[model samples]
Target: MRVSVILPAKNESEGLGRVLPLLRSVLPEAEIVVVDDGSTDDTAEVAAAAGARVLSSPYSMGNGAAIKRGARAANGELLVFMDADGQHNPADIPLLLARIEAGFDMVVGARGASGQASTGRGLANAFYNRLATWMTGHRVLDLTSGFRVVRADRFREFLHLLPNGFSYPTTSTMAFFRSAYPVAFVSVDVVKRIGNGSHIRPLRDGVRFLLIIFKIATLYSPLKLFAPAGLLFFLVGLGYYGFTYSTMGRFTNMSLLLLSASVIIFLIGLVSEQITALTYTRPDRP
Candidate 1:
């Protein structure tokens, strides 16, 4: 299958200059698509000169938006996505492709400590991995790595489900996993950024990242994230109702209100699950 490499860049002109030449060497046969998200610098110009088909958004559309734009323009059976900030190795593309050919719908470039990120970011990433793995019942060693290879058709189905922001990975992984799509991880060395400053802040993006995970979990399979919680609420309400009935020999309205509210919340979760499915389900979905 033909491979397509999609790079998302925003004001990453300097970084992209160094990244493109190496990428060309590693993936000479693949189609290279770079989406420049309203970069004020020479990002688009540099990418075009380096042989990548450039697509520019009129304004800053965010990382996820750039990815989607590149994907739409890509023409290959397999899609390889990587950051243009030069944190990912182009050499790993072959390894990712090899795993994809082995029948996995997606091959994740799991980050390793060898050339990984900052200490604060590393700790947070580790925490995210643990929480995500527990939630999805699938080990998620690198919950936010930007480098990955996915089957194009499988990825296209979830295009509308994507948010035009940095939380794409969290949502994509959840969607594929919730749909029972096959996935595998390939270890990769994450290099430090090639530029002056990182766009993501450890404190800011990390919290947003966790919230994204919870949101995705809720949408994917509400039962997995909410059932236990709903059950706990219901039980507490049930206990209060029983105690009040036994003590007063009458059913208290407050107790009933709590019980009703608990059940309603669970019903809301169930309804949300159905709505989430519609985002990627077949045309004949219920």
Candidate 2:
């Protein structure tokens, strides 16, 4: 299969200087396209000097934006996306591609604990992995890893759902699962970034990542989130009603309100589930 490797870069001149040559050595025949996300530095120059096709953005759009642009420009049946900051290893490209050839529509590079840049980020990734596993009913080794290989056509199908920011990996992974595509994960070791510090802010990206929990439910299975919430409310309502009936010999207004709320929440969940199912149905299917 024809393969195109895409590297999304934002002021990553130093790392690209090292990574491009190494990447070329491993996949000499593959086309390397670098999307420079509005870098003021010499990122575009470095990529060009390394003999990579560089696509420049006028202003800093976001990581996902760069990815989308690169995907659009890549001319290959299979597309590989990796960080330009040197965190991902070029040798792992073959591993991911091998998995794809083995009938997997998408293959993700699952990073180990040592791969994480900091303890806080590691904990966050673990939480995301667990939550994704529960939501998809399949084990998710890494939900936030940027290194992955995917069939070009399959990846483009859900491009509209991808965010403009850093959460594209999470969105795409969940999307493939929801669409019933075959996805696989392979363990890989990651190294420290060679250039400047990471762009992700813990407090800011933390809230964004938390919102991904809600997206997981909406994308793969709405009932996973709504059902639990509804059940909790229902159980609390029942307990409160029981207490009121035993103490006052009558159902209080609070009890009536809680019971009504429980019903409303459950009904909402049911409706949401139906809508979710409809969205996933293929246009080609009857």
Candidate 3:
């Protein structure tokens, strides 16, 4: 089977020089597509010189935008996405694709780097993943892995759902799992990034990452996210009314506000479910 490997590059021309060659050696028959995400450096030239088909974005769109662009330009049935920062190993491409071939809709590479980040960072991701998995009722082994292989046809449906940021993998995984698609994970070695520095700032990007998780959780199953909240609010409203009436023996306006908000949020969850269902429905489906 032909595989399309999409590398989203931004100011990584020098690094691409090494990554592209390694990929060429490992998966010779696969088509390599590099997306120049508005890089000021010679990323386009270097990618071309490395024998990669380059898709140029005139300006620096976000990482997910580059992925969507590269995927659209790819011609293979299976699409493998890798980071251009040299953290991913081309040698593991086959392992990822093997999982896909074995009948998984998506195959993710789970890096063996548990302490890869700081204690706080690692713990945060672990908690967030568990919470997301619990909310979606799907087993999520890795929520932030960029090294993955996905069916090009099913992967295309997630392009629009992808936010223009570094959390594309997490968002796509949640959506796929929410839709009941099978995802498998392969353990792989994690190498240090080859470039000078990482583009991520743990402090700023960490908050953004948390927000991304919330967005995905809400998008896939709003009720799963809001239902608990709605229940809490409903209970609070009822308690408040009972306490106020028992104390003063009179009805109050504040209880009305709390009850109203509870109903609104619950309605929001119902509306979100309908919209989400309509978004994925197909006439061809039984």
**In order, what lDDT does every prediction score?**
0.84, 0.91, 0.84
lDDT of 2 by residue, 1-286 (tens): 9999999999999999999999999999999999999999999999999999999999999999999999999999999999999989999899999999999999999999999989988998898899999888899999989999999999988888889899999999999998888999999999999888999988878788789878877888877787788788878888998998898888888877877887888888889988878876768843
Ranking by TM-score: 2, 3, 1
- Candidate 3 residue spans exceeding 4 A from truth: 113-115
- Put the candidates in lDDT order, highest first: 2, 3, 1
Q: Least accurate stretch of 10 residues (summed lDDT) in model 2?
A: 277-286
lDDT of 3 by residue, 1-286 (tens): 7799999999998789889999999999989999999999899999999889999988989888999998889999999999887888899999988888899999998865452556776676677678777877776667888889999988997788898888888888887887777888888877777665777788878779778767876767878877777888889988999999999997688888888888888899889888888776667753
Number of colliding residue pairs in model 1: 0
- Compute each candidate's TM-score over C-alphas: 0.89, 0.96, 0.94
Give the residue spans of candidate 2 off by over 4 A: none
lDDT top scorer:
2
lDDT of 2 at 33: 99
User: What is residue 259's positional error in candidate 2, in angstroms?
Assistant: 1.9
Residue 20, model 3: lDDT of 92
- Pairs in clash, predicted candidate 1: none
lDDT of 1 by residue, 93-198 (tens): 8898899889899889998866556777778678777877887788987877789999999898788878898878877877788777888899988777876577
Output the number of the TM-score-best candidate. Answer: 2
Could you tell me the lDDT of residue 39 within candidate 2?
Answer: 98
